[model samples]
Target: MAFAANTALISSPTLFTPSKFSSSRLYLSVPYKTTKFQLYCKPSSSLPLTSLFCLRKKEKSVLSALSDDFPAVLDEIEGNSGWDVAVEGEEGEGGFVVQPPEEAKVYVGNLPFDVDNGRLGQLFGQAGVVELAEVIYDRITGRSRGFGFVTMATVEEAEKAVELFSRYDMDGRFLTVNIAAPRGSQPERAPREPGHRIYVGNLAWSVDTGRLEELFSEHGAIVSVRVVSDRETGRSRGFGFVEMSTESEMNDAISSLDGEILDGRPIKVNAALERQTRGRF
Candidate 1:
């Protein structure tokens, strides 16, 4: 007696041949008509294999979409399990090297004052190749600004860094790690008004009042965009206040901009509190 096999591939599909395994179970994703189902099968001579046929479809694997590294990346991650371990090192040495402009960059905050370029590179290098690591500092005081940027070799590496370090407590502070916004892309600032207002926090340093107003203007009429800056340096405080033309506009701005990424930072948008009227009382 003889048996026949029929297979149809519609899109990207993975098929396991019975000849590959003599006595083991193989799992496959089989698509039929418009439905998809999982198939667990073991081929044996006694059983009719006609029902084990499959119609294949061409589609990119989810894993492939994530990164071309695929299974190899898994091994890399496992091998670097000791990345977070701290080692004794010198301080304030191995100054930062500027990386060529790249999209795969991450922001790191809440760093210890003593952390230098070398220390930061060691910590983030665990995830992937460290193209550059720089600690922001005040030009006048020559002191660390308590935050910095890390540029990875690839987007995959940058994502891995964020997953490994975001909100991870190091030393005595919890770190805030996120994608870095492109340089020079600032937020717009609006003028303070008598109407409704909101508070926006975690803004990127590059963002200015004009950009902030432009972003919030989509929700409603923005009365003003005031990004609080330091009196001495005039740098952004990483937070700002916004006022809208009306209460409805304010609410709309809150709903739209909250949790949205602006200049690679996830901003916090909420209603502003009223100033206490102590003198009147």
Candidate 2:
């Protein structure tokens, strides 16, 4: 029997899908006013029947995002016994966003370059129970970034760890342990103000922050000074950075102190370059 179009008006306005019908071929009748999709099945004398699907009001002349082999998929779907649901994400979830956990995690900095996740968990376990510990690694080089985060079992435990480990020496380097900031809570760091900083090289291993400050304080109002140290030995790395109060002070220091001797070594001074980074995506 041939069923005319618009002959069947589903009272609930429920969708008419081939999965709802058991027959190999269907002369389904649907109205444009009701369904978002229209389905028409073509019966073939071959093993599998062909089906055509179309959206009712969509003006697109094509399926814009279909893969090259999507047509092969339609050919493969024969008389399916059930409806197939599609999900967006790779894990089969519908692109769900996960919320950050409670404030029981601590950021651990000044870590040794060789520290591993297991070591971090063990170290943080000294204060209280540790749920997880992971060392961040460089994406390309796969080296530890000398910093990691640790999740405590309770907020009180996290607080205890912060109190006990902040500035606590680990492998000759003092640690900077504190509550981890929630991701995305901070704005992107602004660029450094122009001409307020200078890079000093050819530093002596004996030179510390205090010594460097004493040396440069004569040139300008010193904002801060730091002597970079090796993560392993906690000794000066023969270079440092200094920030002055103003552009004029920075220029005066760079011009007058470039070849000045400090700690028996002639230091090289120049405007500090912005640090290069592999951007996080």
Best candidate according to TM-score: 2
Model 1 TM-score is: 0.34
Clashing pairs in 2: none
lDDT of 2: 0.67
lDDT, candidate 2, 89-175, per-residue tens: 223223332322568989998676778999999988998888889999866557676689998888899999999998776764467
Q: Who wins the lDDT comparison?
A: 2
Q: What lDDT does each candidate get?
A: 0.65, 0.67
Error of 1 at 51 (Å): 69
Model 2 stretches with alpha carbons more than 4 Å out: 1-100, 187-199, 202-281
